[model samples]
Target: MDIKDLLQTAIYQAAHKAIADGVFADHELPQVILEVPPKKEFGDFATNFAMQAARGAKTNPRVIAEAIVERMNETWMEKAVIAGPGFINFYLKTDWLYTMLADVLTQGENYGNSQAGGKEKIQVEFVSANPTGPLHVGHGRGAAVGSALVNLLKAAGYDVASEYYINDAGNQIDNLAASVHARYLELLNQEIDFPENGYHGEDIIDTAKGIIDREGDAYLAFSVEERLTKFKEIALQEKLAALKADLASFNVYFDVWFSECTLHQNGALEKTCQVLKDNGSIYEHDGALWLKSTAYGDDKDRVVIRDNKIPTYLAADIAYHRNKLERGFKKLINIWGADHHGYICRVKAAIGSLGYSPEQLEVLIVQMVSLYRSGQLVKMSKRTGQSVTLTELIEEVGTDAARFFFIMRSLDSQLDFDLDLAKSTSNENPVYYIQYAYARIASIFRQATEDGITLSEIDHSKLNLLTTECEIDLIKKLGEYKEEIIDAAKERAPHRIARYVHDLAGQFHTFYNQCRIKGVDRDLQLARMGLALAVQTTIRHALNILGISAPEKM
Candidate 1:
C-alpha cells in the first residue's frame, strides 16, 4: 500500500467535504502534496494542501488547516495537527505498520511492485556501443543503468523493452576492418600502415590472428577492397559476440539487438529523409542535404546526406527513432554517453519534425567513469588493447559489485569506481553490507528452524508487540519501498532504487542490533521473525530489480 498516496486521498476527501459543507467558501481545491516531515516528532506525514488552498479559499492558511483537520475522519490516522503557517501533520496509528508487514509477506518477490505506470509501452535503448572494440568501463556503466531502469519500469507496471542499437554500418566499421587488415599483414610478416584512427585494441589483433589461423593467408591474393570488406564483416561479428558475452556476464541482457544496417537496407533512411523533405524540414545546401534543425530549436542546421552522398550518423539516428515510433512504442528512452548532451536537441528536433512530440523521447546522459586503485587512476588495459574492458572489470570485482557500484551514483554525476573498495569484504563495501544483512536474516531463520519453529507456525497475532522505536522505523522504511520505486520510475532515476536498498539495509542492521530475536519471549520472537522475513523479502526484491543477487550467506 502507498501510505503517502492513501494519506493524500484521505486529506483530499476531508477538504472536499469541508468545502461542500460550506466550511471554506472555495469552489476550487489545490493539488494536495504530502511529504514526510524532517523530524519524527513533527508527524508521520505533513501536507501543505491548506496553505496552497489559502489563496483560493480567501482565508488564512492556519484557519483553513483547522477546517480541514476538523473534518478529517480519523480511521487510519491517530491525530492531525496544524503547524507552521498551515501545514497539516498526520500521525498514523500502528495498525498501518502491521498491515504493511502483512502486505510485504503476501507480495513475496513482488513486494515493491506497483501499477503506477498504467501499462505504457516504453522502449529503453542503451549501451549501443559501436561494434569496433570491446565494451569498456563506461559501456559497463551504461549497461548496468539501462538494465536496472528497464527492471524498474517493468516493476512499476510498464510494458518496457530493452534494446541495443548496433552501430554496425559506419566509418567505425571501415576503421575496424582497416585495423584488422593491418594486423593480419603483420601476422604474415608483411608491412602495412595502420590507419591513425584504426581500432588498436588487443581484441582486434586477436580477431585478425584467428582469421589468419583459420584461413591461412589466402586473403592476401584478394584485392585490398575485397579483403577489407570481408575482414570488416568478420570483425563486426566477433566484436558483437564479445559484447554480448560481456554484458551477459554482468547480468545485462537486451530484448532487442537492433542493427543500424537494417535501417538503410529496409529503405527507412530514405523514407525518413523523404518525410523531412516533404515537411520542409530539409534543404539542399553546399552540394549536400541538410535538415533545418535550427527552425526546431537546434543550434544550427545539420547535414543528413554529405556531399559524397553518404548519409551522416544523424540521418541513421533519425530513421532509427522513427522506426521505434512506428513500432507503436508509447515512449522512447535512450541512455547515451555524457558527450552526447549537445546531440539531444537535434534528435528531439528530428522527432518534432517527424510530427511527434519531442516529449515522447527521453535521453539520459550517463557521465564518464574513472577507475581508481590505491588512490591512483588506472586507465589502460591489456585485454581490450587500450581501455579497460567491462569483462575485465567484472572479472576483478564480480558482477554484483560491478553492477551495484556502477549505479550507486546518479547517471549525470561522474563516477569514481574504487577497485579496492569494490573488492573489499568489509562493511565499508556497500554491496557487501547489504548482502550481509540478507545473510544475517537468513541465519536467524535457520536458527529458528533448528529450534523447531517453522515460518508457518509464527504467531503473527503478536506483530503489534513490535512497537520499539527501531521496529517502527524499520517498518516505516519497508513501507517506503513501493513509493521509492514509483518515484524512481517517474523520474527516470534508477539510482534512487540503489540508494533506497542501501538505506533499507542500514535500517535493517540497526533493528537487528537493537532488537534480540533469539532469546526474547516466544511471542516477541515470532513477531520479530516476521519482521526479519519481511526485510529479507524487501532486500531481495530491491537487489533483484538492480540485477544484483541477495545472498543467503555472506
Candidate 2:
C-alpha cells in the first residue's frame, strides 16, 4: 500500500466519524486528495477535502476541517492543523518513519513496487520512424521517454508491452529503393539520374556500397523493376536491423515490432474504412473517401482515399490503430514527434468512428531537443545526411547521461541538452551527482568493514536512534518512493521518478555530511547501515526504471 493511501484512509475515517458524531450535517463527502506541501512548515502532507465538502455539509470550510482534525485519532500522525482556506496539513510521528525504513531495507529493490494499475493491460508504441534512414535526435528523445514510461507503468503494476511500429509500406520505401538503385548505378560508373526527393542521407550510399560488395555486379543483370524490388527488400532488412541495434545500444527494447506492410496487405486497409462507413463515421466526396473527422472535433474532414483509388497515409494509420484494438489492447499509447500534433484529433476521431472511445488512445508528443556545449547551442548539420543520429548522440555523451538528460524534463516541453555538462565529472551534472551518492554510501560500508562493524542483523529497536534532522529527512524522502511511482504512472509522466531519485540522492548527501556511522555506538551504527542499504536499494531501483545505472564506484 502507498503511504498516501494510508493517510487518505485515516482522513476518510475521521471525516466519517465527524459525520456520525453530528459535528457537521453530511449530504455528501468529497474525496481526500493530498499533496506534498511546498514548504516544510506546511506539514508533511496537506489536503483540501474540507474546502470541497464545505457547501455540501452546510458549514464553513474551516469549521469542517477543524471537525475532521479533532476526530483524526491515527497514532501515526503527530498532529493535523487547519491552514488557510480550510486545508488540513498533517505532520506524522517519527515512529512511522522508523517502521518504513525497516520495510525499505527488507523489500530492497522492490520498495517502490505497487499495484496501483490493477494489472490493466496497455501497449506503448514509439519511435516508429521509417526505416529509410537512421534514427535522429528526435527519435532518440521519444525512445528515451517511451521506454522509461513503459518501465514506470510496469513498476506501478500495469500489464505493459513496448512496441516499435515499422513504417515500411509507403512512399518512403519506394524513394529508398530508387535512391539505393541510383547510388548503385553511380558506384558502377554508369550515367544515372538520382530519384528526385529521394533519401539523400549518406547511409543510402553506404547501403548501396554494401550491396555491391556482397552481390557484386550480379544485380545489374536483372531488369529495372526486378532489381528495384530486390533493393527494397534487402535495404529494409538492413535498415531495420540497424535501427534495432541502435535502440538496443540505448537500452531500449521492444516486445513487438509491428509492420505497416501487414496493415496494407490482405485488404485490411479497405476493410477498416468499410467499418467506419458502416458506423456512419465516413463518407465519399469528389470520388474520394473521406472521414467525418470534424464531427468528432477534428479541424476538418480528412481524406482517407484519393480519387485515383489509392489510400492516403491517414488510411493506413486508421487501419493500424483498429488492428491494435482488435488485438485486445485495452489502451493504445502512441509516442509521436511534435510535428504530428495536428494528427491527434483525426486519429482520435478514427477511434470513435470504429465504435471505440477516443479516450482509449493516448498520444504523447515529444517536443524538439537542442544540444548545447560551453553555453552555446551545438548546431546539428547534415550528419549522416540528416540531423544528429541516435548513434552519434550515444557515442558522444554515453548512454546513461544521454538517457537521463532526455528523461529528466517533461515530454511536452523543448529540452536543451548540454553536451559539456553531460560529459563533465562535476556535481552540476545530475547523473554524475546521483551516481556519486551511491558511491558515497558504498564507501561508508567499506570504512565500516575496516573498523570491524558488521551489519549482520538489524536491531528493530535501534531504528529509533535515527532521530537527527538529516536522518528524518532522508527517511521521509525514502518513504515517498511508492507514492511517487503511483502518481508518475497515473499522470503518464516518467520524469517524476527522475526528480524523486535526484532528491533522494540529495537527502542522502546531506545525511552523509551531518552523520557518522563508523564512530557511532554499535547499536546506532547498525541502524544507520540499515538505513544506508535502503537508500542504495531505492537509488538503483529508480534508476533501473529510467534505463540508467547507479554505480557503486563513481
Candidate 3:
C-alpha cells in the first residue's frame, strides 16, 4: 500500500476502535482526505479527518486527532502531530523514500500508469470546425486540449475514442460551394457574382485552382444544381484531407470522423424528433416542432424543426448524442468554442428529453487565443492573410512549443500566446525548459559512458545512499506522478499534468545542481544514476501525454 492507503486504513481502524471502546459516542466516520502540506514545516502530508469526525462524535477535535495518531504505521511514519484545530500532519521516516525510488526504477516508463478508470468507455469530440477554412488559432487550442485529454484518459486506463464531428450538412457547406463556384468562374474568365455570405479565405481560391487543374471547364457544362452537388463533394473531400494532414503534423489524430450529414441521411434526426413527440417532450407551435427544454433547466424551449420543415442545428446535435449513447459509451465529452456557451443548456436539455440524463454529456468551453509578438497583439497571419492558422503557428514556433503554450492554462481562461517567448530557446520558455531537463540527464549518461563506465540495471539496494535534501525532494516528486495523473483525470484537466511535469523538471534541475552524480563515491553515484533514470522516464511519459516531444539532446 502507498502512504495514503496506509494512513487512511490506520485512521479508519483507529476511529472504529475508539467507538467500540466507548471513548466517544458511536457515530458514522467521516471520509478521510489527505493533501501534501503547502510548506515543509507543516509535515509531509496533512489531513482533516479529526476535524470532520469531531462533530459526529461530539468530542474535541484534538482528542479525536490524538486517538487517530496513536495508531499509524510506526515503521514508516516518524510522527503524526495535530495542528490548527485538528488537522493531522504526518512526518514520515526516510525508508519509505528508498522503497518509492526502487519502485520508480522498477516501473520505469510505467511509473505513473494507473487503472483508476476501470476501463469504462469514453468518447471525446473536439475541433469540429467547419470545412470553410483552415483551422484558426482558436481551433488549435481546442485540438491540443482535446487530444491531450484523450491521451490523459487512456493513461488513466479508460477505453477512449477520439472523434471529430464534421459540420457537413449546414449552410457552411453551401457557402463553401458558392465560394468555390465564384472562384472557379473567375479563374475561367467568366463573370459571376460571389455569394455575399460565402467563405472568402484564400483556400477557396486554391480549391478552385485545384478543380480547374483536375477537370478543365468540365464542370461548367453541367447544370448548376449538378455542378454544385459535385463541387460540395469534391471540396469537402479536399478540405477534410487537408485538415487531417494539418492535425497529423500537429500530432493530433482521431478515431472517428463523424459527419453531420450522416444523421440526416440515415433518418436518425427525424427518428429522434418522433421519439420526443411520442414522449410529449416536444410539441407543435406556429407550424414548427419545439422541444420543451425549459422543463429540463434550459432558459427556454427550443425549436427542433423550423416553419419550413427544416431541422435546426440543435436537432442534429440531439441525434448525434443519442448515437453516442446507443454506441454504449458511458460518457460523452465535447470540446467546443467559447461562443457556444449559450447552446450548452438546450443541448443538455435535449439529451434529457431523449430519456438520458444530461450528466452523461459534458462540454468543455475553450476560450479564444490571442497571439502576441514583440509585445503587440497579432490578429492576422501574414502568410494566410486571415486569422492565424494552426499551420502558421506550428511553422513559426514548432509543434511542441505550440501545443505546450496552448494548454498552459485552463480551457475557460483566455490565452495570450507569446510568439517571441515560444520561439526562444532560453529557460524562460517553459516547454524548452522541460525538454532540456530530459536532454541534460541524457548528456550526463553519455559523459559517464564516454569515461568507460557502463550504467547497468539499477541496484535497488543502493537506494539507501540517497539522503540529501535535494534527493528526497526529487524522489517525492517522482512518487507524485501517479497521484497527479489520477487527480488530473478525475477533474478532466490536462493543465494539471502540464503543471506537474514542469514542477518535476524543477525538482530534477535542483537535484542535478546539488548532487554530484559523476566523480562521486561509486555506490552514491549508482544511487544518483538510478534517480536520474527514473526522472528521465517520468519526464518523457508526461511530455508524451501532452502530445509534446522530449528530445534526448536539445
Give the number of the best model, judged by TM-score.
3
Task: Give per-model TM-scores.
Answer: 0.97, 0.97, 0.98
RMSD, model 1, all Cα superposed? 1.4
Q: What is the C-alpha lDDT of each candidate?
A: 0.90, 0.90, 0.91
Candidate 2 Cα deviation (angstroms), residue 471: 0.5
The 10 consecutive residues of candidate 2 with the worst lDDT sum are 377-386
lDDT string for model 2 (250-345, tens) is: 999999999999887878898998898888888889999999999889889999999998999999999999988998889999999999999999
Report the Cα RMSD per candidate. 1.4, 1.6, 1.1
lDDT of 1 by residue, 14-64 (tens): 888878888777668888887888999999988888889988888888988
Q: What is the Å distance of residue 322 in model 3 from its true position?
A: 0.6
Q: Give the runs in model 2 whose Cα sits over 4 Å from its true position.
A: 1-3, 381-385, 450-454
